[model samples]
Target: MKGVVVGGVSSGVGKTVATLATIRALDEAGYAVQPAKAGPDFIDPSHHEAIAGRPSRTLDLWLEGSEGMARNYARGEGDICVVEGVMGLYDGDGSSTAMVAEALDLPVVLVVDAKAGMESVAATAYGFREYAETIGREVDVAGVIAQRAHGGRHEQGIRDALPDDLDYFGRIPPSSDLEIPDRHLGLEMGAEAALPHEALSAAADHLDTERLVDVAREPPQVDPEPAGARTDATVAVASDAAFCFRYPATIGRLHERSTVQTFSPVAGDPVPECDGVYLPGGYPELHAEALASADTLTELGERAGEGLPVFGECGGLMAMSQSLSTTEGERYAMAGILPADVEMCDRYQALNHVDLEATSETLTARAGESIRGHEFHYSKASVDADARFAFETVRGDGIDGDHDGLLEHESLGTYAHVHAASGAFDRFVDRLR
Candidate 1:
């Protein structure tokens, strides 16, 4: 396997579009292309799956352990693999995409938003490559993709500023057809969401796909012993357009320890008979009415009342509330697992990272244990005194008084989305087993 990791100087620099386009082109060229995202993002990976015809796995060095990162990269059994960087090349709390690249020893293809100042772009690229070096690994700046170039000035400025070692791979001129729609959580995905096939096709046509693929190291083999005998534990995962904020690695990890079952809250499906249930974040607000009226909510409430271990994050947290009030002030009854009334707020709540301390034992977590996760949502949860379970604390700057994560009875909810590879995640899941 050989490939190039595509990263932007910052967000909105067309890295996702360029990455998807590159993957599409490689797939078209008969190369087995596997796509990976750097952080704990679900939407971009969903879009990558749309283009690459494969599920995009996440490789967050902060969330997933170094061994997990290496294992994921090595699992990219393709002629070419494209790893898309999150926020920025070196933008992460403890570890970042640059660290992942270093761990895998892969080359990087920097994507610059050329609409901005071009004269300083070279310095930015140089800084990123240097940052990679300081972390004990040499990084090759294979080339740069100048995005949103207009009037050729941006490209020319970038080319002029580049040092002799770096190459200007290609440019993608601005086009109205290329814009991806966004919401509070991020990009929306469904059968109806726009796929941007033409835009990706055009971007792929301009990049040097052959050269980029030549640098990707081969993926490693994961021959973990078959999962041990199935445990009595079962987790109910919500799977639908509205509730799809789950990492494949999380599910993989869960299955490694016990049997896992999936159910959709949108379709009014019954929660599978299981020891526990997990509702990862998604767009429950968008489908507030349907979910509110769904019979599944009543059933989940019934199950939770029976003391089954239940957990929700972000949208899932919202879904498990007593009521959900949308931005329009429309209210809908929810699972009522927690005595919390969740109301939609005008502003978005996007907590990127936090230090999580377990205040109570709900899932596989023990009291006083600490972990790290990210939280992003817009729902404000107001709970009654009786249902509150204070099991976690945020050590860093967090939303709403720097206290993040929520606990209610046997149910756990939080905006902080932890990756499966995190030690906290391992401990949490171990308790579930």
Candidate 2:
């Protein structure tokens, strides 16, 4: 599992293009390539999956922890793994990409938008490298790939500005066709609108493959075992477009221990015969009306009433509410299990690094146990005082003042999005078993 990280100076810096291009290049070169996105983004992973022919997993230090990251890296069986960074290198709440790099001990390839002069570009790279070092991660600046360089002089300017020790990868010329379409959530994931294979091949042609391969080093190896020899725990994973922020590593972990089944809330799908349900995060507000009228909501509410163990995060939490009102004020009845009303807000409520102290035994979370994760959503819910669960204290930006996980019977719902590597998933499975 050799790894390479593609980071940018800031948002819109072409990390996605670089990541996809690198994955395609490696795959074309006959290397078993695996892709990993840095943050809790669902759309980017979809694109990664389209290119890699496998699901792209997320590695968030805040949510998955150091051990989780190591386990995921070790488990990912690939000749070369590419991990794409979010926003910028040091742009996470408390655990940034630099932190993740340090946790996994992987080298980084900095992608700078060279629309500006050379000296400024060099300064930007210098700042990122210094920041990575300041955080105690001695990240090897494998090389710099310039995007949108003006003429050939932009590369020279960057070369003149950078230190003699830094390596220079190639540059990607500006192209209107290479731009990926975006929507309110992020990039459009429909098959028709996906990035063309030719575009990815062109980007790969521009990148210095030899340099990237040189910097890429394999992760520590772990023994692989035969499947289906594990316990009989069933994990119910949400699988609709509205709530699809799941990581392949999470699913793999569940499958390693027990049988994993998927159910959708959009088709009015019934909850399969399972001991526990794992509802991931996604854009639930977009389909609030359909989810409100779906039979799955009613069935989930009934299960919650029966004390079935259910855990939901982010948009899943919004769907499990009593009712949902969209940003346009379109109201729809929801599960009515939590006695809470969710209203989609015009402002996006994105928060990173949520630390919680569990106050109850729901989902096997012991009282006084603390867990770390992140939250990104646009809907706000108002819970009745009598219906709110007093399980955990949340310390994050989106959480108003102090917040706790909502509990109804054995169900726990909240806006905090957790990684599958977090012990929470395993604990929930074990409790159900």
Candidate 3:
């Protein structure tokens, strides 16, 4: 599908608003808009999916290689894809928006905060466009979207000042309604707090929808392969506000080989009867009290001890631990599946692309095989000395500097969040089979 990257000058520069507006504008122009996010952020993509009416493809070169990222993009069912970029246009090492654009060979429309100046916005856009050439990056900053600018003369001044090479896509007008609230993990889930449709429609009215469609180009051909090898294992997944950081593609992959069941451990649900259980990452810290009283935790601990294969990532890692002690000094009992004490932190412990080389055979991967994923959390897990480890960290922070993937019985707990494209899910289902 044809795609375009909605890049920003930096974080909090209105990239999400501009991208949402662009999606609304394109959809209004009779195109099926598929949204994609440039980094390993599950939050921004929530807003994208809320606006676009579909799951936003998570494209990160570090977690998923160029081909893997392309394949994820190829799975989208739409005429065009609008990728909401990460921090800045040229921020990350390998997972930057520019790198994703280069990988997909897609054009970019820079989102500049036009709240302050007019002509200066045009200059900033020009710098982002030419800075790519100076840094030897294969990026095409085709146009500019003036964000937080007022209508009438303010918008006209910004448009009139733009260089002939850069197209004036449109401006997201200044309004309090356009802003999305945030928490420790970033913006609240779009389902909880999405911008109203009328505000998005207003921003779309000013954009050049024809030009957006004109600038988009098709991505390179990707390998059409499913996430994991097929198996008929029943995989019970933890769901609800507490354990909600799962990808649509990841669930889709599990459905390809397993009967997927979802139960909320935070809502006092019991663990379902299944051969395997997949616990995703989310805000378990916020719902610790409820989770402490859940039957699922005790049931899961027992089942995991009995050799039922279990895979937990991030918040899941915390949930399967001995206990969770919050920063406010409140202590809650967890599943006790892994020999570790998880504690909430004042700041993020790990926030980047992660690489883990399996040290031994684990529930999710075999020995010697590497898994690529991302970890972003504000909690620390202190493992018991007798606890066995399954993976040695190659990149980013794990439980410690060197090791991740704490192992006990048939279950594995790690801070790394891997997608279906990483082949971890395949290994997971294969192990269950």
Candidate 4:
């Protein structure tokens, strides 16, 4: 599919709104739009999926290697793909928007905040483009999207100020209706706080859909990975608001090898009968009270004790722990399968691309195997004195400063969220067999 990167000059520059408007514009212009995200972000992609009506491709170089990221992009289905960048074009330690754009060889439509100044917005866009070469990165900052810009003189000034090389794609006018509500994790899930369709459509009307379509280009071709061999084992995945921070590709990977079933713990559903269970990350703390009264985690604890392979990540880790103490000082009992008490903090405890080496064989990796993932959470886990950890932290702060992957009775919980490209899910499926 032909694609273009919608990058920002900096964070909070209305990139998500611009990208959503761009998607709406493309869809209105009779094109199938595929949305994708640049970093290891789940929230932004949720908004993308809401607008594009498809799962947004995750294109992080750290979680998934260059080849893996390319393959992920190759899997996207659409005539035109709009990738929303993370932070800024050059920002990020492990993976940046520039890296993803360069890897895909896609031209970037820089989103410049033109709310205040038009000439300065053009100058900022030009500086970002020129700064690419200074950093020895081959990023094509092809044009600028004047975000929160006005009509007449304001839009004209931005257009006139652009250099010969930079194109003026269009402008996203200032609108209070375009704003998405924010919380600790970032913007609330798109399903909860998605902008009104009328407002989004109005914003879309301002974008230059023709210019965007013309500038979009396809990334390099990649050999798609063969589907995993199917197994009889059924894997039950937790899929409610509490456990919603899962990558679409992770579920796809699981489905390739097993019968995937989803149940909501927040709504008091019991865990399904399955050989294995997968609990992803999300706002478990927010629903801790409901979870405490739910029977799902209790049943999961019993099943886990019976040698059923269970893996939980981040919020899943919290849900699988002994207890969860919310920031409000309320404590609730969790699954008690892992020997830890999780407490929600005002500030994020760990936020980075993670590298882990399995010190002992676990559901996701064999002994001594390295795994790449991402961790961004606000809870801290206090483990038992004799708690058994399966993995050693190599590049991030795990549960402790040095270790992660709390293991007990064939169940494993970790703060890091692993991608299917890391071979972790494949290993989990193999263990289920």
After best superposition, candidate 3 residue 115: deviation in angstroms? 1.1
**lDDT for each residue of candidate 4 in 253-320, tens digit (9 for 90 to 100):** 99988999999999989888889999999999889999999898898998888888889999999999
Judged by TM-score relative to the true structure, which candidate is superior, 1 or 3? 3
Residue-level error in angstroms, candidate 3, position 59: 0.9
- The model with the greater lDDT, 1 or 3, is 3
Model 3 CA lDDT for position 2:
91
Report the C-alpha lDDT of model 2 over 1-433, residue by residue, as the tens digit.
6788888878889888878888888888788888888876777888888889877777876776666666666666678889998888877666777777766778888889887667877777777777766766676666688887754666777778788767777777677767899865678773436688887787777767777888788655444433434678888888887777777876777888878899999888999988888778877777777787789988988887897777888777887788888868788887777768888777776656778877767673677777777777777778787765644546775334377578887788877776665667767777877
Worst 10 residues of 2 by lDDT: 220-229
Q: Summarize candidate 3's per-residue lDDT along 1-433 as a digit string, tens digits.
A: 8999999999999899899999999998899999999998888888888889999998989877888888899999899999999999999985999999998999999999888899999899999999999999999999899888888899999989999999998888888888899988899998889889999998899899999899999998966874445677899999988888998779988999889999999878888889999999999999999999878799899989999888999999999999999999999999999999999988888888888999999877889999989899999988898989999999978998789999999899999999888888878888888
Whole-model lDDT for model 1 versus the true structure?
A: 0.74
In terms of TM-score, the best-performing candidate is: 4
Which runs of model 1 end up more than 4 angstroms from their true locations? 115-124, 130-139, 150-162, 190-194, 218-229, 396-405, 423-433
lDDT of the candidates, in the order given = 0.74, 0.76, 0.90, 0.92
Displacement of the residue 42 alpha carbon in candidate 2, Å: 3.1
Pairs that collide in candidate 2 are: 1-219, 2-217, 2-218, 359-391
Off by over 4 Å in 3: 226-229
- In the range 1-433, model 1's lDDT, one tens digit per residue, is 6667898888778888778777877877788888888877888988888787777878876666677676666655666778898888777766666767766667788988777668777887888777766766566666687777654566677888888888777777677777778887667662446567777777667666666666556444454433434555666778886778888777777777677888888998988988778888888888998897789988998888888777887788888888999999899999988778888887875556567776766564577877777666677777676555544455543334445556655777776777765654455556667
Model 2's C-alpha root-mean-square deviation from the true structure amounts to 2.7
Better of 2 and 3 by TM-score: 3
For each candidate in turn, the TM-score is 0.88, 0.91, 0.98, 0.99
